[model samples]
Every structure is written in structure tokens, then in C-alpha cells.
Target: MNPLLPIRHFVPDTEARVMPDGRLYLYGSYDISRETTYCSDILHVFSTDDLVHWTDHGAALRSQDIPWASEGHLLYAPDCIYQDGTYYLYFCMTGSYEGVAISDSPAGPFHHPVPITPADRDSIDPAVFIDTDGQAYYFWGQFHLRGSKLNPDMITLDVSTLNTCIIDEKNHGFHEGISIRKRNGIYYLLYTDISRGKATCISYAMSDSPLGPYKKGGVIIDNINCDPNTWNNHGCMAEYKGQWYVFYHRSSQNSKFNRRVCIEPIFFDERGYIAEVPMTSQGAEPPLSAGVPISAALACQMMHGLFISPAADNTTEILSHATNGSWAAYRYLSFDAPKSFSITAAAAINGGTVEIWADSLLLGSCLVTPTGGWDIYRTFRCPLTPVTGVKTLYLVFRGNDLKRRLMDVKEFCFYGDCGSGNAD
Candidate 1:
């Protein structure tokens, strides 16, 4: 599997929540790959137990499905929370007006989306927090931060209780994308702050109540150059199985509009301050076990012409557009003892080799054999040079003719002498 590949593209403005069932669910703005738009007009939900494999729950809501929403307006940041045996999804539409939808399930084809925030308010990026006392609060804004205590219905906010300046842009750097979460009795307000650098950084403020009195808590992550055109960052934090994580997005394909979601493990010190987290290819979990079935879609990195995309039957395969130096990389797999690797792939033409490497060391190569058709699948194997312990894996697709497409890789696994601490 591409162990660290983004769950699906193009997911931006991520809000991660751990459902009562223990699975992590993702809510974000979706965009078509290589599209010019910042986000699409629909939302798709994805869930996972381990970060490696994700199941798409299909479209949760669509702008066209909302009677008040314009057909092609951008579907910006969204959020979801569970309370009273019901799940509520909040999102911002084209005009920056917010709305709410209700569903019995977390992964929903949510229904009855009625406008919440007034049309006059400049609202986007809605964040919902349910407090320990059963009180729910809704937060949203762009240039300025505004919030209010939500009514029992979880959709409407009391106009009298609204604070249109919970944390202003000038004071707390709250440009947009606000997320609220509580830990150890501390109310944390996370958002995009422009005070740091060229692109927005993930900064936070702390409060004693759901609607603060917030004090600047400093930055939790700085702006990054994940892609040369990277512009802004937006995300949320959730604790899963006693581990805390930061969910964020980065622009890719050299376009600021084409963003992909990424995550990293985060920590709060004994003093209750969060340390900054750096972007990494290793991802949020421990090294995956060797010799286990790994989806080719888990590639942590892919060079040009190499894409993990769906095939004719709607299953994913490595689209190897045989350009010179096209490659895919999966990082940090644990191997306790020596082993050989095998790959399952399909190719209509022969002459390219799947070059395997462990870190900087070349393990071996498997020659691509003609399989009668591009969709015809077959297994190929090659002996390794006995690499031990944990190491990054690189699969380079090199062909005798650089201009033609290589082969589609379905999956890969390792096998050989038994060794402790190797792939489970």
C-alpha cells in the first residue's frame, strides 16, 4: 500500500473527528484533481481505523441538493459533531452563509440543510463544539471571528447570545478556519493566522469557557512549502485512542487550489502547551508491517506521470505513464530479517523494470512481462540483497523506451526467512 498517501484528492480544510465507534471520520472541502477551482460543490466522507486504508462513504451533501445553495458556488470548510443520538454537519456556501444538515449516521447523506447564519454575516468555515455540560457552540468567520451558543436543536444560534468578535483578526490573527476542542478543562481555539509568514499558519488561543476570553497560545504549526505554490493551511485536531493528532492540508501539483489532506501526531506538554509539528513523509502512525498486503495507493510520494488512480473496473492501480524517472515511494516499513519482494502488476508491453530500493540501497529489479493486455494481471518476483530493520521503499518505473506507458501496479508484499520485528 502507499502507506502515507492522502485518503482522497482534493481534500482541503480538514476537520477530523473520532466517532463513538472508534473510527476516525473526515469532513473537508473537495475539489476535482487538476481543477482550477479551490473547492467543489459537494462533500464526500471518508473513515479509517488505521491511517493506511480509507473507505469512501460517497457524497454526504451537494450544493445542488440544497435548495437555497447556488449550483456552482464553492463548498468551503465543513465540520461534524455527534450529540443526542444525532449527527449534525455544518458548512459554508458560496456567499459565505452558513447552514446545517442533520443525519442519524456520521457518514451521511445529510438531509434538511437550512440556513443558520444570517445572510448579512460574513461567515465561512463553521466549527461546532459540544461542551461537557451538553451545551453546543457554533463558531465561524473569515476576517473576524464570531461565535454563539447554539440552541438545543443544534442548528440555530440565539441572536442575543452571539459574540461577533470572540477573537478578532487584528488581535488573535484569526483570519479564518476556526476549530474548537477541549482537553483537561482547557478550551482551545485553533485557526489560520496570517501573522506568521507569506502563507497562513496553524495558530491557537486558549479560553476557560467555550466562548472566550481567549489568550493567544502561540503557533502550533508554521507555514510550509509543501508545494512551491502552497498558499494556506486549514485543519482541526482530534484525539483517537488516547493519541492526539493534527489534521491539515497542503497544496500540491504546483497549484494552490489543488490541495491534499495530511496529518501528524501532536503532543501537549505537562504544562498544557502544544509543541509545533513539522510536515513529514512518515505520517501519523508507526512503520507498517513488512510482508503484509499493502495497497499501491499508499505511496507516500509519487513523481510525475505516476498516479494512484482507479482502473476500468473502478479499482485502483498505479498509472505508470512510462516517462523517464517516474516513480512512487513508500516510507518506513519495518523488516526484522532478510526478505525478497514481489509485485502484482499488468502491462500490455514489455521492456521496463520495476526497480526496487531500500533507502539508498538497490535491492533488485523485476522485469515487466507482457500480459496480453493492460488489464491482464500477473505476479512477478525478484530476490533482495538482504536489507534489515526499518527502511524506506522506492519503486522506480524505468522503460527501455521512455516515452511509452509502463505497467499498472496493483499491490506488493515481502517474503523470505523468518526474522523477529519484521513485517507482521
Candidate 2:
């Protein structure tokens, strides 16, 4: 079977959580303008009752509300931990150390304070995992990595027991974005090895304790084809309906749209080790029988053409037109009638025309307007006519002038029956 392709284009600085009420909530940075030095401090929230469709709940948290943050510093990776009756949001402020806020609800008007870890330590990408014994541990670090135990109340760290964690030496000590989970009395540490460029891989380590001397395990997922320059990193793992998944981000067409998130199915071997994860630059198939309906929200992993550089002056190659962004078509499906679908993108595109064709025949064209930054997620619905037995859909973008740019696509959702068969 073919791998799954990204249905939508762009979701930036991705963070995900499964709420106690049995719904999935995704929070991340939004309205990040490419031209601006700093993106918005707003945390946008989307919820899915079924993974296939999504409901936008708007901004869940904003930086202006956090008095500790600078006037325009970007709010990086945000994570949540549910303890007692409150949800704690651990996030990075101004790229220094990690700090946190608390709310009674998952969707929060969070209360922020000064940095949790000392500013001199240079920590970020905070992940909070509560052990079975009810002890809370905080994991954060990139180049200079560290982890420490937090008090049971989930506020401050237990300073006396700070533990320095191990990042793979094979990757030139480049490590950050640590995600931890305990299974069958074993602790697994998952993190990014970014030293190899597009060859960047997700590596793992194992330990007997939550705070541990973790021994390095080999790479779990390696070398995503879609992102030949960069691969998946900075994500979290969760179990839904008895299945496991890794949610992560890859570079968009370029740096401006570089951090869009995607997900793939994961499983543990009989020996209690994580099985090798499949890497796809595009996207992956939905998990089987997860009990949730496939909603538009589930399509978020689909890669729309983003980060394609602008074609050279007077260039006409089909690939050249994607100078600012590009996409690889996969697992194409056909339908007998017009199908309802949605499209979302990020960029400040002007005068660029998107042509959709099948079987070498022109279907139609739509004018794409740029969303002005990587953080604004836009969705559009339209009727797409499928060619009989067509196995591929072609998207062509033609820039009006040198000012033309492309955006990352987060996902596309089709409602109503087009045709039914195993697509990938």
C-alpha cells in the first residue's frame, strides 16, 4: 500500500493533547507573518470530536496576557499537563527557559508568572510527564539539554535533584524537543537529531526510571522523502483508542513555512520496544478503528504546496513555477460526481493561479490569496470534479510577477461519497 499524503498544507509550532472529555485539542502559534521578526503571541485552538472534521475554537491563550513576556517576543512550543483539577500550560517565553501558567480547563485563560527554570540555564521545549506514583517531571533542552523533577503541585521544580539528560552523540550533540512516556515499567525518551540536515532523524533512548541515565537506541524514523532537507521533529506521542501515534512538524516549502506539523502511526514491539516509524514528507494513513469519525481536523497532516521558492525570471518548467512552494501527488482517488472539499494555506500570495487537472485534462483554476503569514490557518470549501479512474490530481501555480509567494497547506477534507476503495 502507498503511504498517506498531506491533505492540507500548514500548521505551525504544533502542540497536541487529548482532553479528559475524549476530544483532541491542538494548540499552536498563529498569524505569524513571514516579514515580521516576531509572530503573534496568540495560541489558536482546534478541537476534533472525530479526527476527520475540525471545529476552530479561536485563540485559547495570548502572550499579551503574560506580563513576563517582552512586548513582541514569540511564544514558542506550548504543552499541557492535566493534574488534580487544573491544566498546566508549560511554554517557552522569548526562547529562554520554560515557564508555565494554570487554568481549571484545558482551553484556558492561563495565568503566567516568571520563568520556571533559571534564565542562565537556556532551557526550552518543556514537556511534563506525571509518573504512576504521581510525581511530575519536567523535560526541556535543545543543544544544552536538561531535565528535572517538579513538585507534585506541578508549579516549581525540585532544585536539589536536577538531572542532565543524554542526547545522541552520533548527531553532533544536537538534541531538543524531548517527549517522555512510561510503558510496562520502562521509560522511553523520544527526541530530534537535527545534525544531518534533511537527513534529520527521530532517535530514541530507554531508561528504567522517569529521570534516568537513558541509553541511546538507534533511529526510529529516518529521512522523509518529501522533506529532503528537513524531516519530522518537535512533536508529542499519544495513544487514542488503543493505538499509538507520533505527532510532529516538518519544514514547509522553505524556512518561512518550515514548521508545519504531521502525524504517523506508531506501535511497540513484543519486546516492549517502539517499532520503527514510517517516514513520509507528505502524510500518512489514518489509524484503524480509533472509534472517532474521520473529521476535517484529521486531515491536518496533508502537505499543501508551501515553501516552494519562486521560479527564476522567465521560467516555464512545471516544477519551476513552484519556486516558492511545491507538492508531490500521491494515492490519488477518483469520483463520479463533484465532491465537496476544503483547502487551507499560509502566505501573502498575489496574482498566483492554482489549476487543478486530472488525466492531462484541465479541470479548473482558483485564485489563491496569501494569508500574510505562516500562522494564519485558512480553509476554503468548493466542489471538485474527479476524472473517471483518475489516479492523480495536479496543482499548478503561476506567479503574476516577482512579488508572488506560496503558502503551506494544512489539509483538505472531502465530504460525501466520491468513490470508495482503499486509497493508500
Q: Whole-model lDDT, candidate 1? A: 0.77
Give lDDT tens digits, candidate 1, residues 1-424: 2223444457888899999888999999997766777898889898999877888898999888677766677778889999989999998877776888889999999999898855223668899999999899988888778888889988778777888788977888788889999999999998998886654588889988988899988888753545546678898888987888878776655567877787778899986789987564567767767767666656655665665455566535344444457777677788766467777777787647888888898988877677767767677777877777888888888877767777877778788432122121
State the lDDT of candidate 2 residue by residue for 81-113, as single tens digits: 789888888877564646788878787767754
Clash pairs, candidate 1, are 1-294, 1-295, 2-298, 2-299, 3-298, 290-423, 336-422
Clashes of 2: 37
- After the best TM-score superposition of candidate 1, give how far the Cα of residue 297 lies from its true spot, in angstroms: 10
Clashes of 1: 7
> What overall lDDT goes with each candidate model?
0.77, 0.55
Predicted model with the maximum TM-score: 1
- Judged by whole-model lDDT over C-alpha atoms, candidate 2 comes out at 0.55
TM-score of 1: 0.71
